[model samples]
Target: MQSFRTEIENPVVERDIIELEKKISLFRTGQIDEEKFRSLRLARGIYGQRQPGVQMIRIKLPYGKVTSEQLHRICKVSDEYSTGRLHITTRQDIQIHYVSLDRTPALWAELDKDDVTIREACGNTVRNITASETAGVDPREPFDVTPYADAAFRYMLRNPVGQEMGRKFKISFSSSEEDTALSYLHDLGFIAQIREENGTKVRGFKVLLGGGLGSQPRHADVVYEFLPTDQLIPFIEAVVRVFDRHGERAKRMKARMKFLISGIGLEAFMQLVEEEKTALPFKTYPIDHETYEKAQTLPNPPSVEVAEPTDESYLKWRKTNVFPQKQPGFYTLGIRVPLGDFRTDVARKLADLVKTYANNEIRFTLRQNIIIRDVKESLIAFFYQELKKLNMAAFGYNTTGDITACPGTDTCNLGIASSTGAAVVLEELIANEYPQYLYNSDLTIKISGCMNACGQHNMASIGFQGMSIKAGKLVLPALQVLLGGATLGGGQGIFADKVIKIPSKRGPEALRALLDDYEEHAQAEEAFHEYYQRLGQMYFYELLKPLSSTDNLAPYDFVDWGNEEEYVKAIGVGECAGVVIDLVATLLLEAEEKLSLAQESLAEKKWSDGIYHTYAAMVNAAKAILTSESINTNSYASIISSFDEHLVSSGKVSLGSTLSDIVYQIKTNEPTEAFAQNYLEDARRVFSGINAFREKEVNA
Candidate 1:
């Protein structure tokens, strides 16, 4: 790889890029294990695509906020390293595809120049911190969550406590009681709230814990009705610590925080979080929101004589795609990018438009669309004309006609069928046949390549999950139709029900049946989920079962969407959460690395960070030894106990105290400098003892 080390201004980021280059070199020369290298690259936002030798880089944009200059930088990187096309993800990040793995370091260096990042965009860390795109401007919001979200993202970006865990942790901040950010579906969700206390107003949040959507979805439990704003980051840190200690590791499917909390019960999980509070560095980490509250210097509205178009299409677009901000005389314009895919040429033009006319800021929505904020009311006509020139002024920004779908079989290894292909057909059907639904916000449609729900299929009113069905002697692509899902606001939601399965080619037909049935049904002015509940799941199943027939299958039905050949069921190992390799030598090496980090933190006088790093090092050493014994070490807590039972009790290794008492000290004592120093020494001793024992065994 060509050197671009001097391009990065931040020394820490510079080292990170250089380290990635070194690791890639090591992996290429067979010095680094593939699984270990996979984890390393994933933390930097390099993800494996279905196609080999090329990668998809996810550029992390906290709360979906992107400056025009940053967008231009992203487009430049896309053009230089990969295809000049960008895909906005449901998590509010941008992914560019088909780039050589060798160029990732340079790509990252380029993005960092504009203060953009891809760190923790993937892997078992805190993923992108998302919030309502209308956060600052939403009239219903008590306070803007942009500052709080940015603070959380900065704090957790490279925190040692969340560096590696059994599974990824997702966090969201909703703008208001409407819960537009979908707080209920996250691992740790905060809904902005405020209440009066003795004639003084104070900001806080309604906290939700442990919700997830997949093959089996769970609703998050309300842990607190109102947690003070200052305690938000501290509370989040405690929860992450507890999860890292107790979360499942052996069972990949059950490794999510939702499963762990459900297995242990929410009450017990809260107790664990409470227990970890003392180890936290802050009792109340106050965020500086005054800076964010400061008024931005927006562009002056240029005087123009052009009149607003009187066409029905423009009128409908105005009603649906334009929203008024809390700041009077300003509007936010939503641009519907179908399937979250757009060309770089259009992106550059959009960036220029926003920089010149709007607030120079654009936010990618959770529904995989873009919104330009703080546009003057007078410039609406001018902006619309400019956007129309770029072919980006399409109607139905986030309505029934705007379907959200993942890049299923097109790029994902776990994809069973072509979700993007199916989405195109369904969207076209809605545009041509169901134009009346364009203004309807009561129903939603989402599709995923598989049960993983990356496209958020389970949370939509009408959802489809990719699958396959065997008919007679042949296999064909299929979709699992889901219904009755909706968000009820205030941190509450319902996951869609799996109504029936049908051939992939019939996805559009199935949607047509559902919409047609709803249009002709008895109820007046009923929402889609409510209509489904009124009739029940069995009714929809029976209604769509006719389309599930495989008896009269055509030759085209055997082929998946967007394909010309016969369908083949080929599934690759997914790297969504990064793989875990239990190689004994690798684990020991990881233990040594953790000890070095612990020492570094102690030297820097970060007491709490040092103590946590020490705890991790001790646990890693224990897990390393237990892996050699072939014992089940599913969680860090289990690793501690199993180490005691299998090795410590057997007199094979000797620590001054039991491993639990030493490791669990983190939960008991405060993270004082004295404790941090003692903890680091303990970790070093434990790792040295384990290393000596392993060396003796190797020598024998």
Candidate 2:
């Protein structure tokens, strides 16, 4: 760790690594509580894998854009510190597996050298902000959203408001009304929009709020039809503040922003957002697009004529994997990476390939694939030949053959079965038997190792979730077949209905049955989504119900896919979100930490951050006192109200009127310099009064 210390040029990031090193030492020595230490490391993007002792390090790539140099840097880090294997997630982030937990800091230090980050990649923070992979190249998009997406990522990277929350908050930016980023399924989604105002073209977004996908997926509601791009950042900040204050803290399953919106309808949540506007630091946060929208240098292809490949496979590959960009004379080539896994050797070569044949950049798509943009037309054949050498010239880019899946039981602790393994089988089945389905974009297939839907099985036209069934006394691995899910576009989508469960080995047979029925009876004009709705869920269930029969289970039915051993179900604890610690001492220590942070923010004159820190400090202080009396508080709002009823109303602690008045003053006043200082002073006073009351109670 000390060896890499001097290598990291950024002082703040270097300090963060040093702090993590110290905390790891303390944790190993049992000086720090396990749960507390977990929270600290999670916020830093280090996660524990199912395999004991090692970790899965999620490398943060903003909007999935990677410069050639950055890609090579990631490959180097993976080769040295991890298994040399890189996996792309559904959220457009890359993950490396089986890394030693102790070496994470060194790995992070190496990544920092290239300006890539893993901070806030996991554990209850604003996750990697995603956008349409085709943002800059798509023909139908109004304007590229690269700048706005970059702005959101930069502003919220380590912002105090989103540092901790009841659950994760996901944000996305779509390039156009096509909503290729799947804006309808994010906590906050921004679809790029342009309107002519006073004869000037104005850029804005159709904002969608509170959408999420897990076991129960919810479509996001439109927060604004056309919000000027300037208001995007401020609006998101205020919404996060509200979520941090009132979102559920105890029940892990119901802690997402979608639940909060559902519990208190969208109108009520919007009202709360309105109430938080004055406290926001900026009224309109403008993002500069000069750099983000700049065009790349056009490549000069070889002047000599080159023979084009005559292979039939190359034609199929060309048709599905290449897109003519809106920019004349340039094309974007999509690489269908099977199962989102590729060795570092391929990655290094691919990195060099892009720099040589196209622009020095690439974008990782939401479907877990890579897209190389701005390629010269003359270089298409050269790229095809080069990709053929690397065996990365697969035809289907985002079609049925290009199946999307999470790394289910392979590494994820929450995985009940092998999602990736099943994905491999399904992809082979499509390429070998159902070859006609290769270019069929309407027929989507996605699988999850479990119901958490990391694979986004809930939103696929044909989805499968990992499950287990009891057959006599033995437990057999199963897949819950689902149907009818589709993204309706323009901020609309439908979640699949669970059709039936079949033995894991019988999954292939079930797919065959579903397809056979669809091919024979479906109208030629009907897409998969239309056919599914026309046929209904129960109809498909009955069509495939024969595969669900357990009476004929074979010996292979007990084993999960890609596993040789007999499957014994073992699901480990999920650390997707941190559990709120209930200890009074811990709460007090957290309060003091917040106070220290408050001082730092005050010194920086970040009034909004400082004020929020002070507010959190006072609430934590009140909770500490309440805990001393054996009273427990759930949410931040309840903590304030209970303090008033138990201490302020009883005259044990005085703030002139009520604790609510003291704690809730942030809403009444803007986050000005004067108000920030005054609020900090009031927090100091309230903190002191709470300590005094606690001492008195202890003495009695």
Candidate closest to the true structure, highest TM-score: 1
What tens-digit string does per-residue lDDT give for candidate 1 at 37-78? 888888889999999888989999999999999999999999
Judged by lDDT against the true structure, how good is candidate 2?
A: 0.88
Clashes of each: 0, 0
The residue pairs that clash in candidate 2, if any, are: none
Best candidate, lDDT-wise? 1
lDDT of 2 at 521: 81
What number of backbone clashes does candidate 1 have, counting pairs of residues 3 or more apart or in separate chains?
0
After superposition, candidate 2 runs with Cα above 4 Å error: 301-305, 626-632, 651-657, 693-700
Q: What is each predicted model's overall lDDT from 0 to 1?
A: 0.90, 0.88
**Model 1 scores what on Cα lDDT?**
0.90
Instruction: State the lDDT of candidate 2 residue by residue for 1-700, as single tens digits.
Output: 3889989999879978898888889789987778777777888889889999998899889899999999999999999998899998888899998888788889999999999998999998999999999998889999989889999999998788887788889999999888889999999999999999999999999999999988878999998999998899999999998998888776888989999999999999999999999788899998888765565456664553557889898999999999999989899999988889999999999999887767888889899999999988877888898889999999988998899999989999999989888988988998899999998887899999998898999899889999899998889899999998888779888888999999889889988888888899899888788899998988988898889899987888888999999998999988876565656666777788898889899998888889989998998898888877766575677778888988898898977667798888888788899999998998888887877877787789
